[model samples]
Target chain A: MLQTPPARPGMREDEVDTPALLIDLDAFEANLDTMTAHLAGTGAKLRAHAKTHKSAVVAHQQIARGAVGQCVQKVAEAEALAWGGVADILVSNQVVGADKLARLAALARITNIAVCADDAGQVAAIEAAARDAGIRLSVLVEIDVGMGRCGVAPGADAVALAHVIAASPHLRFGGLQAYHGRAQHLRRLEERHFAIGAAADSARRTVEMLRQQGLDCPIVGGAGTGTFELEAGSGVYTEIQAGSYCFMDADYARNLGASGKPVAMFRHALFVLSTVISAVRPGIAVLDAGHKAVAIDSGMPLVWQRPDIRYVGASDEHGKLEVPSEAEAPKVGEKLRLVPGHCDPTVDRFDWYVGVRNGRVECLWPIAARGGFY
Target chain B: MLQTPPARPGMREDEVDTPALLIDLDAFEANLDTMTAHLAGTGAKLRAHAKTHKSAVVAHQQIARGAVGQCVQKVAEAEALAWGGVADILVSNQVVGADKLARLAALARITNIAVCADDAGQVAAIEAAARDAGIRLSVLVEIDVGMGRCGVAPGADAVALAHVIAASPHLRFGGLQAYHGRAQHLRRLEERHFAIGAAADSARRTVEMLRQQGLDCPIVGGAGTGTFELEAGSGVYTEIQAGSYCFMDADYARNLGASGKPVAMFRHALFVLSTVISAVRPGIAVLDAGHKAVAIDSGMPLVWQRPDIRYVGASDEHGKLEVPSEAEAPKVGEKLRLVPGHCDPTVDRFDWYVGVRNGRVECLWPIAARGGFY
Candidate 1:
């Protein structure tokens, strides 16, 4: 059902198979510690988004490093994490269908499970599933802070949905899910600041409305790798759902920090290790990793440590790198590390992550929740 | 390790879980029959690309309906197809690493297996693996033929690689793999014809060169859904590797035929069925299907049977649909069918394909090689 691990323990980096997802364990551990230390006593707990890494092994590491719990987008992901022993899980996105809600409720027996709803009908569906399963499921009323994707309106409409969940015997009102997803990639610091500022304002109003209805908003969750600091400092968001901080991608590295440098809080830990399968041409080389291996939704992957070579184009299974004439062409079978443009979907492409340290394979972790999209 | 199937047999279409991949059985059957009838006596055999639909069940169906065999891009895919009882498999792309080549060579014991190579180093690596595995492996010299991805130069370079394969004791020179990948998506009929025309000329010369070297070219494989007819018509190509015809995507649907209409050869047989999880805002709706559910490399998905709605944007787990003011907004919990922009990566996202016919799920097929990216 899954491909074999690209590298085994004790193997050198060059010996690992091409198109394998490689994690720099040193940088990965540094990111975990850095993020944990940065978030300590910040008033906002880190409910690290499992949707990025999609690995229960990584989730356990994050949990050990002071991450309060894990946040996922699908019930199947929750099931995977729970089965992998992740006790506190939240389906941060909306869980719609009865089949999925039932699955979510079923996990509540062994783990503390929570899901989001943006409408009365979704609340009804979750309620029915929880009631049928004889479980009390935590429900988060997701308010559209600014993303314009999911969630209900912020003020009265969100309060109304919260009341519906409060009225359901099988459901508990968790709080507001005010995620500004688009702001996470806004490149400019000012753009992100403005976006999260508006998002925080909307979430604050929604919380007030809910409090006016005699409901206590225990959790106001929203944040990603790029904007977690803004939300953490906003005093409104209690839970920061920053996932990519543990595995920084090329897109996140492009974001300008307050100090005018690429966000340096986390180091780039994730890489798609590929081999130059074809370099017969003069100034062009092809890699085994392409769209199928590393996602290009953000843009083409950056050739790590090779400034002269640029990933120009990609087909399904091949990525074309434009090599400068002055730079030596990578010979056939030569391996290179590629920083994926996006981490989540790139991580979704593989079953195993070969964790490397000092150019040697140190660990092979199964992406337990990989492709858990139901 | 895979997620549970979204739907079981005998379930209605609406009852199926959201973000599930659906196969319209009727259209799928039509595509198979139409492709078979079109390729009958064309002198080129249909070697359906398994990379498009990584299901051994689908591979068997294609083989049963006159396909010569299946073509894959990865060794794991070949292994999966062979283990699923596919007797013949060609890795249309290069198998780079020694580990991958060893796995491919191991498969030669049970199934007729072949792989592509461009460089002398790759040939040497494959020869080493085949020799170590004690198997005579078939090797194809992939010529650029204008794809500019993999493959050697057309005439002399291809002949030189073919000779290298012929000289190897464990390797046999199969033929030329000259796939014009970019030409497959040419919007105009003239553009595709021109591209494939040049590709055929190059392939024809390469074959002549191989023959001049006293090597018999057993196969000259190329062609995809968009240009299969041209390659089948060309006297030089012995095999048509058209895979997307089995499940036409939105990108392929946008290609114009000779008659100035959408290429009507293949019907849209695959769709991502998603539930409208959020519709609280006016003129906006959100679906459970997004980048994780459907690939957006080609473009955003098309709303099947809903002309008034447009899939405008997508995040990781949510798709935003822009609805016309006059059109009825899709209510929460309403299911909609989405024709994926690119079918290959979209299919790779799911573990199961729910086969539907006449508004009911008739079969559940496991995508046996869903994540076969080695």
Candidate 2:
């Protein structure tokens, strides 16, 4: 029942399957090269965040473009990337539970693995797991850099956690995990700049305090697609960990560039290929991509090539499109490309990305990290 | 690195693993029986929605309980259910492209299958695929029953489409699909009653016209967890498609019952098992389940069993729980259950379901339909 590739391989846009997750190889490579060229000759290293792509194929590409390593939030993501031959990985968050810790420790045997901690209990858990696995684990003291999320307070408290990490024979002090997560999506460029500035100061202070304690800080990681340039330019952040730059989402599109135009780091590559299923009314149509196909946590999906048609609402399987009276309404069998508001969670909704080039599905890539939340 | 089962099968709640999808077997079974028993002699059939469970295992269980078959929104989902041995499936949504339509028609070779449509072009495409495959595909003319998303207009427009479905050599007019989708979550009991009332009116009108056109509608499907009782009691809706009842979510819990209490057809058995990774300050703890683990489109995740702690905000990997001064603050590495606001998409985020009885993983079920979005 499965149809052949939509268009012949290497053909242009008309042959890709509907409801496929697409990544424009041309735009994706440019985004990577742009990030690479932006930080060219700079001391800051790019540890491309795999949480965004969740594909080892993409991860290998990022590595090939001179990314230091990859940063992931879960053990499963690290495992998938590692199995794909990614040698260096940072869990970048606390690893709790005996089961998850054991998985994290096991990854170290295969790759250059590091994890972050904000508590002595978590550090002890990592130490116990590393000891049991007969491996040394790298630990970073996560400093609260104005995100008000996960991380201990900067300065003395951060240094104290670093001491706990350094005290363990099974663990080494990798550095301060200073990430201003909230700064990435501040909307206003100035707001993001100030937020990162404050975060850099906290990280700088934490590094000085760790130095005073005779500890060497190696990896100070943080930054996302929205504000990696600011963090990279700050000269304080050692590793710029931007994940979504390769497949920029609608939310990221809201960020103002230096010229105040939309910063075109990446083209709109990732899209929910939806089909117009119902043209029951005069100036209205409903698409097949709804809450199940696309995540709307940020906002509704943008209808590609049809600015006149606005995606007004969604049910689990149907998205209502508000069509313009003057324009021709979409036909029932017509296809539409949807740019998701938030790409990370939206990508989690699909199993395979129908990799299309020109118009045909050249390949089908399983999102190896699609449901690797555990 | 994958750990052994947290607790043996049939263990009690206390022995269950932290952060697991727990289904109260007793309550779950009761829900299934209750639906079937309620519609026992009413001539209506239960085609349990598989998008809720996304498990072939659950689909088989439903089939065992006299369910006419299963309904899915995606072609991949239908394929999974069919492969899992589900004999009858109604895609319940339109399939647009040749690739998807071919997959849909292919299902008919394996099982009794049908799909809904509201447009001529889509019907043409379906007919084309079915003709090419040498298969007769059942087609349901979806009428707009107050849900303005996907459906043809109620009266003549619906009858016309049904006629088209009946006339096509490769397509048979299955029935009228008058699903009042939005009425499922009207919040107020009276509001839902009135909403369903309007929908029933539209459906009744559509049925009357179909009778005039000599088309006896067979499957009048639609109805969800929030308003299934109304549809079942109406004698008009022949199929009650309630998926979330098997895994009741927080949004359904907010529904007001006839007696003014929360609708209690099903219990809140599903939860995101998260651990407190950072206990910064006395009353604030950070959890591992954030936007990635639990969706927040409906609302932020509610703290399960801990009324004093509020899940304030979420980043990609971390959830912030605001502990009230009166609450007992949890320690770092402590596990807590979070009740997600919405169930359908939230369930889509995880790959494995850590089934807990007491405090142990009694069973581990892969979400077979986890990424079956296409």
Candidate 3:
């Protein structure tokens, strides 16, 4: 069940409930425009990932700009987007099991849907599900471009999987899903450049091998907010799947640009707006938000614009802030903004996003896919 | 919005969707019975914390086994439990903000509810909200019993806040909330004994101080699954708020007993049922469940009953498992059970709990407070 919306439009930002997910509308729109600007000269198009925002509203905004479609990590997310009137959807990750594959195939009748595959057995399962649903399904062969989490090895193994997918009666070989997840967070510009360069080389070689086998690759998708520019400029990548650029998190902001500084391309539009509930001890205060409200897997969240106060620890429902002194500690009932260490899971914690502009609540968007992990 | 339940009754556990929250009914009921048997000689009653299970179904089961009430951390969780026919509820954490306080006060019309407070301003806010709602609300003084997250100092500070609650026209001094959360997970028996011994001393002194001031300390609530035995026998804490005892996690299983081994008082009844989506690498496989499915905040989830496989890394939607070798690797589409590092937040990730008995789903219970973080 969905929790009640924390705030109504036209309310002051402080009037929103504590631990509510808040988005600065100006910064959000600017980040969207910034991603559009960065992808202009490059031939690669944007397929903004819905996993980070997890809302049809945000996905529609991205598609209204230049994003060709949306990339989701789960079949349930694809369902949310399709029901929300989005025309194109792609499951950028492999889906196993008959129940999930059937759900993925069912979506093909409503919208253009595709899923990635790494194993021949999984391709066969997808083919059976497509045939059962009486719909042709697109299957992309995901290749390991240095992440080493999912996907097959680059050239030969990838071609083998592609051939199996293409050979299926109800399945079509869409292209390659060459995502380098580990390279996205490399701090230095050269580190990211080197990692994406190697990833790009693997993708290029695999594409050439498939071409030599008389197979045409339709879409070559990879990259995230951290390394999107690198892949976009690589010329081999046709679609860039950068999700966090629309609402940057503290972790991705640590990535360095050419000048050895944090890349200022995307503004921090997302925040976990929390209130100081307890400040009984000197130099210490507790907020209503914790890891349950804002994720700490990436790291403890940074207190927005308050370098003097540090969120030192997080329990399930309490965030402890280590302050300078009693005089400097945030008072009880004071609202503060926190930049989450990770954006995707943090967004998954809330039911609504309170869009704020000029210190007032502008809109409330339902996070329709908050628990769509099925 | 709530997502559909992953399975129907009478279906095999293996037939349920991947990334489903599974409750082993046999183990879960045995855990409840074990807790009840242990608390038979102790005077302290069970006010099972709903923050872990977050379901009225589980709460009713515990209440049927003689639990005094249910404990929740947020007002929204209390709303969920109260609406689900729970009569007595307590918000075991500080709640700030007028919006949340008003909602908490409104619940008194339907259920007997109380909330914890540590600050004078928060107490005043609650008094105002109760007055507006035309209901006399019970307010508890929370003491800092060494968790150092919420709560004020134990003796005079706690008594002073109790006096404020008693003095309010629309509030009553309910009790003392002295929960030493950090003591719950101490590895060694002596370490837990030492920590909880001091915490009990603090609660005792605070209760005596409140008695001297002519204010009766009604319910002294604290303790979790790890240290409930210590608090139950402490002769100070009248109510034990142990939630995870009915559904133990791996972290609680690590607590040491006097025998110098794991306490082993409870069984791991909860699991995140996941499927291996990719196994292309030599000795590595990826599961569809990641941190988004199973929480990794306490630590990475343990591969249930499979010591040969280690869940080494987690992304947004992919869990990377390090297998021993290719021959021993878990094959693609293999459904594996994972014991989450933490149970509460992991339960927050799912909408339904697939209750399995004899390896078949017996019931589907809605996680009524799945996103009740408001």
Candidate 4:
């Protein structure tokens, strides 16, 4: 019942129509290469977070580019990647419910699967599910570095969880998941450096504590698109889990690098192709991409290639563009590309991503991990 | 394959599971009855906005409750309602491309379909589509009623469009669409009153101008969940188009009535059922519902029925809740519901709305119009 997959593969961009999800393949490939080259000789492996791409095609491309594996935040997302033939995956988060845990255990039958646990109860749940399924589950102990959001306390508490994981017959102690979710978008270079510095120290201490307890850390993972360099440079973090680098968003454009320039690791590959529906005022025009078409969590959508036009407001069915003084407003029937403030949630809004290269439709990738909330 | 439907026809709240859409049938009915009662003696009619519900099931309910027709913002939305057996539909916005306009005109073969036009080009396009389909398409002249978003000029410009509509034998004049979208979110009653007052003045002037040329508006539709009362009371707006009354969200709570109290016309029923996936800290817990489950375009989601616990921040896979120092944090596997900031966009995030009434799985309804981005 998908009316017509937004932009089918091999179709031209103009032929694909309006209000479609467009991904610049060249920009996307460049992003993949940039991340791969940066993490080339670094001992840390790149398990590019699939929760960002949510497409098997993208995962396959990343793997071909030399990523060690893929990391997913949900069991359903893992199922998508695994079904797409991703050989290795880490369910970078915990699976709680019996039905979902059973589903996770089933995935191990097909791929090298790993998951994390911050609590003893979750460890026991994973162990029981694995035992019943007659499969060994690779379980990591998540340690809270400084995000204060998810993970066990970074020192002795993390060791205790690691012990619980090792003691389980059906579970093997993986490593530490010390992720500072807040540091990814710290804006200033010094702020991100300080945040990652504290996070690296916390993770180093946790790994050291585990070693003292005779536990070998196999996979110390934690990093995002914003701070992968910081985590990869740290000797303790063996795995870099950056997701949004493939399609950098406006929020990421706010981050500053060491040399004080805005970090430009990735190009703006994703955009919402919208059509001008109404021209109400001299300097105000409304487009079809609105709250439903794009995600505005980080901020309003940026008018791609149109610095003079500002996407000032949005309703359910309309996006209001504020025309700069002395600038000609967009006429009705014109098409515009809107770069979303946040890329992850914005991708979830559409059912398909129209891959456009050189102004022609190259491919249409389904948002397979869409609605993997359960 | 479709995992599940958006909602169920006959199910109680508890049986549906957590984070499902709960339609308070009583409140829903009351809202419809109130609208019907308000427009009973008045010559004006009700064209309930379908952009809010995006479901033909709800559209049918509104039609059964004395509504003359249903109005949707997009052709895809209109098609879903029309396919669901709604006889009369007004696409309250313009359709741009040939594919979409053709789709709009094709619906006329199955139902009484109309659309609004703010420009001559759009009017000509609609006329061409109607002629091609051999159908008489009703066209509304959208006037800039102070919402600087969409519409033609209020005076001669609108009258000129009406004449354009009159010129086409296959097209009929169908009044003015003068929706002030910003006025819907105005927190103060007086502000909304002033906004709608200006809108009504513009519509009235347009109607008078049309009358000078022997044209009478058959309909004047515009109003939203927030400012429906203002437009309904304006004496000029013939049709009250409120959509969110069926599923109120956190944004509507910010709206105040004339008495300065939070508008209590409808109860909050829509929510994202999320599970406590991680308890990383003693006074903090992370839920599975994050940016993907709930939208933050208007603002962050509120913890349903739990004022003490704050939804402090959100990531793609997690919503961080700050538990009160004295309060017990949620354990892993516990479920909580989040009241979304904006229901329409939040609902668009899900493929299905698990409709639960009392308890036990009763029935499921597919979001037939889900991903209708066009």
Candidate 5:
């Protein structure tokens, strides 16, 4: 169910309910403009990943600022974007079951929809669903590029899968999906450069192999917030699908730059706005937000702008904060912004993004694809 | 938004969509019956935590089998239950803000509603909301037994908060809320025995203090799936708040029995039914379910009934499995059941529960409070 919106348009940030997803509009728009400036002449277009924001509002904002389209991971996300009038979307991950493919195919009529395939059986399944929907769906061959979770092997294996996609009755060969997800969080600049370099080598080899078969690759999509600049400079990747760049998190903020310092490419725009609901002792305080309201898979959330305070632990609905002293303890009903360790899954936990600018709620955008994980 | 139901009643279990929440109805019902039998002659009533299942259907089942009421961690959960005909409900955690307190007070008009307080300021806020709503709200003093997340100290502090609740015109002192959350996962039976022993001693001392202050605890609530037997056997707790007993997860399954084996008190009735989306080579495969679909806070989910395959890593939309060899590889489009690491947050990620019995889907229960983390 869609949750009640946590804030009204003109309410102060503190008046907004606890455990709300907050976006600092100043930092958020700066991040988007920063990305636009960075990609101004890179010869690579931005296809912002919707799996991070999950909102068609955010997708449209990116598109208005020069993003080519949006990329999603689930068919349900594709549906939400299509329903919200996103002109083009790519399911950057595989759509496995017939039920999911049918849902994907139905959206092809409303928007330019594409999906990835790593197996011939899946290509056939996509074809069948497209045929059932009486629509020709664009299918991309995902090649393994260090991120071993999904995708076929890069050179010959990828070309063979592309052939299967081209031979399908109701499918169009959309190109290659080579995303090195592990390379995104590599702490060292040299380490990230090396990983993306190898990923680009694999993609370049596969493109050459596809050309040998008289096939022209229309799109070669990959890159993330941490390594978009590297992929853009590689002169190979056509689309930079960087999602977290627009909402920098603590995990992404940890990525180092060429100077061996934490990268400041993007500002931390996302926060879990939580209230100090309990303060039993001097140095200990508890926030209303927990792992249920914020993501903890990367690490525990950090107390925003308060180096003296640390989020020590999380239960279902409580975030324990360790303060410096009793004299400076957070009072009950005090609101604090928490920098979530991960931005993607934290956004998944919320239904509304309380867009705040200058300490006031400016808008409430529905997290349209919040629970559409299927 | 509520998601489309993954399966219809009468459909085969395998025919359901990938990454769907499945409940083995036979196992689920047996779990309910087992809990009923455990507390049958113990004089302790079950008030199963709705934070685990988040379904009114499941709560109704528990109540029909002699559960006194249901407990939730948030006002949104209490609202979901009250609207769904749960006559008696308790907000087992502290509700901090005025907005949340107003929502909770509004629900009191429909059902028997109560909330918890650990701070004097919070008690005053609840009294104001109750006064505004023209209702006498029941407020429980949450005492810290062992869990350091929330609640005041056990004896004097708890009695003082209860006094504040009793002094308020629009609020009534409900009882004592002393839940030991961490003790629920103590692996060894003896460790669990020791932890709950301390917890029960504290609760007993507090109850005595309240009685000496001319107060009575109508509900001395504490205990979970791991230590409910100890709390019930303590002869002091009137309510057992065991939520995961009806839908056991992998973490709870790790609790040891008296003979040093995994306890077999409750069956594993919950599963994240996921499809193998990609299986490129031997020893590695990927599923459609990840931490976003099924939680990984406690640990990575275990492959149900598949001792050979292990879930190793999870990205946003993919769960990577480490299998043995190509001879027994998980094929693309093959369905697999995964035992989630935690049940509460896993249940929070979905909007519907596909209940299956005898290999067919028997019902579809709406996870009505799915995104109601407020």
Candidate 6:
């Protein structure tokens, strides 16, 4: 049910099919190394989020680069990573249903599996599923740090949920999940610093409450690409859940660093390779990649190396580019690379990633957990 | 790899997994019949757009109910539909790359394949590929009927391209491809009427120009769910390429009809079924479905049948809903249905469609062309 790879190893970049996902091997490796080196002595380890890449191959690479484990959003993602030989997997979000909890519990036999919960009913569901599957499950109480999306209230409510998990015979209390999702794209470094500061405070108070109840919070996991440095420096967060740092998206690049410039910690490694399919007009060209190929939830994609050409509009499968009067319009069949506005959903659009280096294909990796959204 | 189905054939709606794509069979059948009956004797035939559903099973159902063929945006879609026994397929957009054109030409062995082009260079590329494949490929001259996308200027430019295709030995001049994509969501009925009126004028003039050049325009194909009535009444568009009418989206629901009310032609049949995973607070609840499960390109998905709850925010795997103070908050594990903002990309997120009727799973259909975006 999957499409074939757009290009094979050693093939030139121009030979790859249009609208295929391309990973710049040099930049990708540099990004991996940069993040690993930055977090070397920070006292916090990387639990690289697989929800961004969804490729077990990428997860394995991160693990080999000193990531403690892979963080996933769904039970199916945990299954995919486990099947691909990932030893430790955490479902960073809540797993609510019986079918999903049963699947998560089943993974415990092959690897270390952990999940998050913000409610007592969710704890009961996970405990029941673990008991029925005859396995022990690690459960984390997700506290509402600052996102106000998911998770229990910061101090007392989170402690209450942790006590429920600790009392269950088949469930083990596994610290806190305090991800501030909205803060990750605050655009200014000061805003992110303040957001993470409050998040860390909430998480710290919750941990103290848990400890007062005779419970130990082993893993205080929270952080993303935009504010990983703040959480890593706080001495509160133990596991960084940074995902998009592996392949910087256009939206993340728009964020300001502490130096008052665009965040430059990670290079743009992921791109949607497209072709100019129509250029009949003088100042207009159309690309084959649109909403289905690259996501627009954040914004329109940026033309990788062509500042003269702007992606002005998009339909279902066509992206319209406005060419500058000073620059010549791109001809038909001309190839271009687009830095996606958002990485996660754009990565979900493809089955394989054409890894390229120096204009040649270096590797082709299958997106094993591409659409594992259940 | 694809994830497991959210529900089996015998499961109830509540028993289905969270974040599953669902098709209400009753509403879906009504939508299908409404479109079929609306275009029964309107002179223009229905060429259902497969880009919306991406399921050959749904395509066969559309064909069985009197659709002329299936319209796709990618060659991979044509391959999947052809493999699933769809005989007639039209790639309703421009296909430029040599690899994609070759694949589209190869599918002519089992299906009647046609594609669109707006440039002389694209015509030469398609001619070369079809010549190499030893097949007579049908080529349509796409005219830019005010969409400002991938098409040539109306009269002389379209005639020139049609001549280029007709002059090629391996290519047959199909007709004119005139689609006003932007006009589909104009919100006001008069705006759409004016847009379609201008599009039909451009198409009519292009057809006349082609006739002057001794070419007969057999298939002047254009029109979507939003403005199919105007194009069908225009006497120029011979085929109606309405895709989203079978599974109306929330964006389309916002469009106004001639009577100054929400367009009531089609019922909302497609939905993303989600479970409340977090509800610890007074009015805020979080759902399991987020950007990965539903596309937010057009807008946020609406909570079906819950006017008091508004989907205010979304992260990768969580949707934050704001409930009214007068209404009770949704409890954990409570199932809810969401009408996706955009039907095409949202349908592209899932692997299977859980067809439900009377609160029970009626059938499970694999989305045969879900990720066929190559």
Q: What are the per-model DockQ values? A: 0.74, 0.49, 0.81, 0.60, 0.79, 0.79
Q: Candidate 3, DockQ to 2 decimals?
A: 0.81
lDDT of 3 by residue, B1-374 (tens): 68899899999988898889999999999999999998888999999999999999999999999999999999989999999999999999988888888899999999999999998988999999999999999999999889978888999888888999999999999999999999999999999999999999999999999999999989999999999999999999999999998889988888899999999889999999999989887888899998888889889999999977899999999999998753377889889999999999999989999999998999999999987878
What lDDT tens digits, residue by residue, belong to model 3 across residues A163-259? 9998999999999999999999999999999999999999999999999998899999999999999999999999999999988999999988999
In terms of lDDT, the poorest run of 10 residues in model 2 chain A is A1-10
Measured on C-alpha atoms, candidate 2 has an lDDT of 0.81
| Chain B TM-score (each prediction, in order) | 0.99, 0.94, 0.98, 0.93, 0.98, 0.99
* Interface residue Cα RMSD of candidate 5 after superposition: 1.1
Of the two candidates 2 and 6, the one with more favorable lDDT, higher being better, is 6
* Per-model TM-score on C-alpha atoms: 0.97, 0.94, 0.98, 0.96, 0.98, 0.98
lDDT of each: 0.90, 0.81, 0.92, 0.83, 0.92, 0.91
Ranking by lDDT: 3, 5, 6, 1, 4, 2
Interface RMSD of each: 1.2, 4.2, 1.0, 2.1, 1.1, 1.1
Instruction: Give residue A79's error in model 4 in angstroms.
Output: 1.6
Model 5: lDDT of residue A287: 91
Model 5 lDDT tens row, A220-338: 99999999998898888999999999999999999999999999989999999999988987789999898999989999999888888999998888899998863478899999999
- Residue A108 CA error for candidate 2 (Å)? 1.7
- Model 6 lDDT at residue B119: 79
lDDT of 2 by residue, A1-374 (tens): 12122333454455555566776666677788888998887789999998888888888888899998999988888988888899999988887778788888888878999999888888898899999999999999988898777789999988988898899999999998888878887877888889988998999888888888799998889988888877888777889899888888888898887677777777777888877777778878888788877878788989887788899997777789998899878887677889898888887666666666655556666677765655
lDDT value, residue B74 of candidate 1: 88
Candidate number of the best DockQ: 3
